[model samples]
Target: MNTSRILRTTNVVLLLMGYQRHWFEKTSHRFRLSLPSVVYIFVLGVVYTACFSQHFDKSSSTLKVLKDISPFLFGLIRVQLALGAKAFAYAIYSSVKSVGAINSLLKALPSRNSQFTQDEASAYLLLTSTFGILFCFAAYIAYEMKFELPPLPDAMLGMALLLPHFILAGSVRLYTVLSWLSRGQLKELKKNAEEELRANLTKDPGNIASAIFTVSTEGLENLKTKLEILEANFCIFAQSLKHSMLFLFAMHANCLLGGFYTLTYYWNTWYVLFEDRKRRIFYAANASIYAFIASDYICLMVVLFMMENERRNFIEAIDLLLAQRKLFSKKLRPIAKDLRGVLKKKCFKFGGPFQPNIIYVSLMVCLQIIIVTLIVTVHYLEDEISLLKEEFSSTDDN
Candidate 1:
């Protein structure tokens, strides 16, 4: 699947976009920060900050359909900007330190007996990344046309929107690739163990000692070592993105809330749309924007949950292997024990405090729905009270 080439290309795009300081050296293929790239990222952040101020200013005036929700929308925009900047900063600073770990994984992949088999994983990454970029550009043009902002500031703001998605896709792709590789290694180890057991059983069913003797302790130890290294690397990877992930988690919730609020507002004002054509267009555009952002958030969440399942499978596979060896002998017990210890360590988790699992994600979704309902109810009551007040004032005058 040309995994190395994919990594090389993606890494270069990230570097050029000012998301990362590190770049692969052309001849040596070593990962190190490029001086120019670092400078460019710094400047890019400064410029984005400046453009966002203008964007925020324009948003309040130009966006008039949901006046009450304007403040919340503005806050969402600010959070998006913050998420992007923080993600970029962490990618440049914390993640660059993991270059050595990344290099080790890269080196290990080529030496492995199995070839890359996950073309679907590669395609998923490429498609999501491409769509994210396209969405950002489309958003930039939409905002610039509607707000009549200058090209430079508009483009900068667009890139701000692009950064989080770009960083996230890259992070998930790397993690997925690692998880797949680890699973492949586990498969080979299991197969090796099974073959030894079968060969011994054929000679004599009661010769458990023969099976234990034939089992390569060295190979078991090596697999254990590899898993340990991968787990440590996962820790580093998680810690590196800790702060950034906090922002991203918040960003997702914020997006969902904002999208729901916008949609609900439009739903309530469905009749009002007939009075103003421009307002109708505005409502549709905002709905579409929120929908696009929300879909991306949801898709990413699902992918993470799927990855979580992959992690669970890894632990289960270890248990199955251990169970298979438990009856062998006292000698096999230590090997089983060591693998069990590896299972005890916490593997990589996404979204910082808000770990991606079915329960937590479902709870979060339910909570958002409840919050939106309360907001809509309160807003409706306020409108009814205002209408009653106007009628009472008119009655008194008559």
Candidate 2:
């Protein structure tokens, strides 16, 4: 409730928002490369070539190709649409970057007394634009579902499956910016308090106790307010991100196991079919793309987990500062006690059910590898048993 606290909060909010705006701007700039669109076009061309080069009769070839590769094609379309939404969001954010317009918009909001800085206004606008893009994309998918009979259901299902991931991505971005701002504010507050205490002690050494009490009390209050704000606004994002990470972890494991299963089951057939140069090229390209996607998902989850860990560490550092007895006077000790109580009661954490530290991350990686290895071993055993059965039957016939 202090004036300095309000100013600091506002400044941090604005800084966090500005970071989002700059991110969108950079993303928009990158979209100029049109890489996603090019990838989509390239994928489409590959499908077309693969479909036409088939030696089967036209009907059989068409059906066979569609059956075999429709999932990949649909995946490409979904990815392209998501990229298009990103580009659209970037455009919307870029068009509203004028300071006057942003300020006016913020002033028009119901919380006008909050005096949202221009940077905060820009950040809110960018967030709104992003949501707008997501809404439009969802609406378009629903609209297409009303008319398109074949791919509509599949497309809708895919969107539904990916919605959590999209939410996690947005939340991660917002939480990261907010975390950085919080850390910066904490550092600044500590530095300013130290300077104020030094000046007070120099002026009147006898009043050092009062200066310490005042600085410690104010710092505790500021830290509490910041944590409250973070908990209220950003914790949901962290929770959602945690859920998304777990989901991705499960997904990657499934992909690994499924890929091994498919390869084992179809190895002989694929070996014969892929003897053709074009078929081998197609298979390799498709496998590489799938591998890249899976790897990217894993990388994203790792980065998000690491960021969450850093945020938790920052909070712990503040807790450590409060625990320092030398920094507190007798009169200010109760305030520090209260701050510790608050922290104990409402500590911000990244994971639910399991703590997401380095050990957890390493465990997840090892679990996937172990599962994949076990699956491959089982598959090999099955193959050996089948070969042994064939040899026994031939011997009996002889």
Candidate 3:
């Protein structure tokens, strides 16, 4: 009963938040914002909670599995929580800035078309904001289920490790929409930048400026949507960064889950079968599994690396505009410089708010790796070795 109430509350909250975000986005299909993807994942999570909550004790094994994995899962999730909170702050800033940018650009641009027919921009913003909201809800559930909030640990770790991945899957969906919104803008920017650079190099085109975009031609509703899109740039930036970490965590979970499930299945066999038992075998398997599991982690780091590299490249690219920073339309270059500075600093300080404090986080991370390798061995190695043993016996008999 309590569970049901909580779920109902969650449902209402999601609906309300989704509604507000949609308003920020100035969506035309106002009726449809009610059915965001967050609602779906929310419903699924609620249903899952309800189903499991009823027979909580009767289903010990399954619950146990969840409990076992909860710690590491919670650790990873806390990081996500921190990221989401940061994203929310960014979104708020972007929403206000986007509105300002659009208004400023509208008043500034006399030649460029102010009337945009398509509202892909709204869709992009809507998807991005809703994704963040949904992810937060999902993370909350994970933190509660896995950690001390409601006190359901055990196999929760698996879910914890897995929750980010699952959330990421949803985020990827939003990214697709954002990629569409960015398509034309990216091309337009590139073309203008390239042409301006060429013209300048040839004749030093004395302070060439690109065009401003606006939607003054659209209706009030469309204007609102454009306003949302304008703010959504920062939202999109934060959203993009958040998804990256999600992707890394998900990949790590995938490997961990793979290894752990294998180990669980072959746990009994190791007791009777081998001297070092399945422990040694599992360790061997962990190495390979860890590689696959961490592959995504590696990819995640690389993506961030590349993003940072691009920022640096942009700073280098705009040498001509550096002198006119005050006159330039955007002011994010300063922030970009700060971000780049942090990345450049090779000296990683140990104790700080920016970095995590929990020593157990490190332990769980290592443990997660070890467990993953063993699980992999159990799943893949035993069968192959068994087959080889069989073949040898057959040869001996012959």
Per-model lDDT = 0.56, 0.43, 0.39
Structural similarity to truth (TM-score) of each candidate: 0.72, 0.48, 0.35
Runs of candidate 1 with Cα error greater than 4 angstroms are: 25-30, 55-123, 126-203, 210-215, 270-284, 287-329, 348-354
lDDT (10s digit) by residue, model 2, range 1-398: 12223323433343333222221122121112234433543453354334323322344443355447434333434443444334334422432232223222222121223454543543343234434554554455445445345343333443433432342343334333333333333344445434433333324556656665555356556645554544444344344344434543554454555455445545654456544544544445336434533444444344445445555454455456545545435555564455444434322444457455546667777878787779678767876798899999999999
Q: Given candidate 3, what's the lDDT at residue 281?
A: 40
RMSD to native, candidate 3: 15.3
Order of candidate numbers by TM-score, starting with the best = 1, 2, 3
Q: What's the C-alpha lDDT at position 15 in model 1?
A: 61
- CA deviation > 4 Å runs, candidate 2: 1-216, 240-245, 263-269, 275-328, 331-347
The deviation in Å at residue 39 for candidate 1 is 4.2
The candidates, ranked best first by lDDT, are 1, 2, 3
TM-score of 2: 0.48
Clashes of 1: 0
Model 1, 1-398: lDDT tens per residue?
44455556657666654555777653454567678877877787676566556555555433343344456555666666776666656666645666666666554343322355575354346335545655665575466457555466556565566555555444444444444444444445446544433333323447666765665566566766766665576555555544554555556565566666666656676446544645554555555545554444465455556556555565565566556553545565576567656655655444345454456656766776687678757866777798899999999999
Find the candidate with the highest TM-score and give its number: 1
Q: Considering TM-score, which of the candidate structures 1 and 3 is the better prediction for this target?
A: 1
